[model samples]
Target: MEFQQLASFVEVARLLNFSKAADKLHITQSTMSARIQKLEQELGVPLFIRLGKSIRLSKYGETLLPYALQSIQAMQKGMKKIEEQKSDQTRRLTISAANPFAGIFLPPILAALHTLVPEISIQVLRNTGYSDEMYKMVMDSQIHLAFINNPHEPGVYSEESAVCLIPLYEDDFVLVARPNHPLTGRDRVSTADIKPYPLLFMGQKTSISKHMLRYFEQQQMKQQDKLEINSIPGIKEMLKQTDMVSMFPRLIVRGDLENRDLVEIPMRQPAPPLVTYLACQHDEIEPHLLKIIQESLARTITELGHPCRLFAERLA
Candidate 1:
């Protein structure tokens, strides 16, 4: 049952000499003999056949030898793995975020993170659900860090503790429609300019949707024809089929913009900016790696010009 007992049984079985087994294990002969005896007593079987001057394995010993060797090997492997983890603790890091932000932002940040900490083992958890779910994971220390969009909303993290909310970038919402949509040709578009077209808004619960509703109320315009969509891809596809314009974080639609599949309809006034925050556990994240993550995020945001502008800060 005990690892030490099994190891002694194996050594003695291999050498077939108690003295030689003890020498190999760097233990006294009597101590090694006691270990084998203890194993035999626990298993209710004598492992050795005493034939005066010679010794040979009994039937039970032969059966248990292979099993004992396997157990020992397994334990050795387990110990080795533990040691590796301990030695490389600083090399492992994990981060999580919601689907849209992760897809649009995480890759560049990871690229920069790798450049800065080439030896690190990075684990990115994303699309795990809402920002609140990601926030909880970071708070629980299940993940080392998280990128949360609009974390300021009530009930997102009602109870805050040692976690530091480092603002990564401020992303602005922009009205986007299919490249050749009627509004794209307009020299200037205002809230009224978009009133004639159908509007595709994100779900009401989202910060973007709430902000859009406020914008409409401010302009005193009603969305006569409107649709609520939760999936970003679904909204993009729907826009192509109809003359509907939707508001999205500008960085999110960079690919469509580059392909000219989606064009931004210039506005007289900017939509409310959604600031993406990096939630890091002070106890979980190392100071040096935290700095790397912050710097990498800043670099990536700067490289990708659009709705996102890096918010500078140093981790104390």
Candidate 2:
């Protein structure tokens, strides 16, 4: 029998009155009676003992009552589960970040979210590769949002592209070395000055490396002695112990600079600042949430001694 027939049977069995059961189910008395009659015919047994104005459950109805109640309860639970899934789909956000943003910005962002939007559930995918992979993820809708260094040069992404890029901030790359390192006292450190010391390079694929390479090419300088370490923490630890120097986003080493654990080596000509962007599928994020994220990052930049410049106005 249909679920409606089963539902009618259970309600009638519970209430023991046709009119009350009909009112409870929001069905007409005639409709309720027809449902019961159909259920009885399907089961080949009478479900109610009719005594003029009163009624009681027949033997078959008593046996079927528990099973019908179970079926109705199961259906209700299944429907509730479906609704819960829909709610989660609406409330949840999945975001990816490049390694540097994940390390420097994610914690504060999460803290701001907890205070501002406690009901929102966040799933953060960290260090999921460089800008190209991040761009792909946003374009493919694999993640709701991504924080990455802008992978493209100027005018590379056209208006026809499915992905939208929101400029967040530009992080200046600074040359850093351990306190008291020889280059630290220089008024203006040049590429030739840095050549004697071992240079620690971030992964070549990293945006920082790409920018540094372009800077070196422009300056016609060659780095003879170099070490490549993909992990930022490892590079920092090495800097603390050795005389090696590396270039990093100022915000990444803000604490070290404050504590005098590391000193910035003034460059004769600084490398280009790394511009970060929030990439997403067009119209995938709510405007309010986007504003909150931007404001949070702005707050973080201010807290970090304004190492990065916040972009122009928010995206239209």
Runs in model 2 deviating more than 4 A are 1-89, 114-120, 153-159
Report clash pairs, candidate 2: none
Model 1: per-residue Cα lDDT over 1-316, one tens digit each = 8999999999989999999999999999999989988889999999999899778999999999998998897689668758978877756778887646687667877887788778878897645636666777876667877877776556656654557787777777778999889888787788888889988987776656666777778778788988988888899999878899988777778789888889988888767777777787664556676677667666666666554677767667
Q: What are the per-residue Cα lDDT tens digits for candidate 2 across 222-301?
A: 88888899888899999999999888888788888899989998999887788888888766667777778888888877
Error of 2 at 303 (Å): 3.3
Question: Cα lDDT of all candidates, in order?
Answer: 0.79, 0.82
Show where candidate 1 strays beyond 4 Å. 1-92, 111-121, 158-160, 180-182, 187-193, 202-225, 302-307
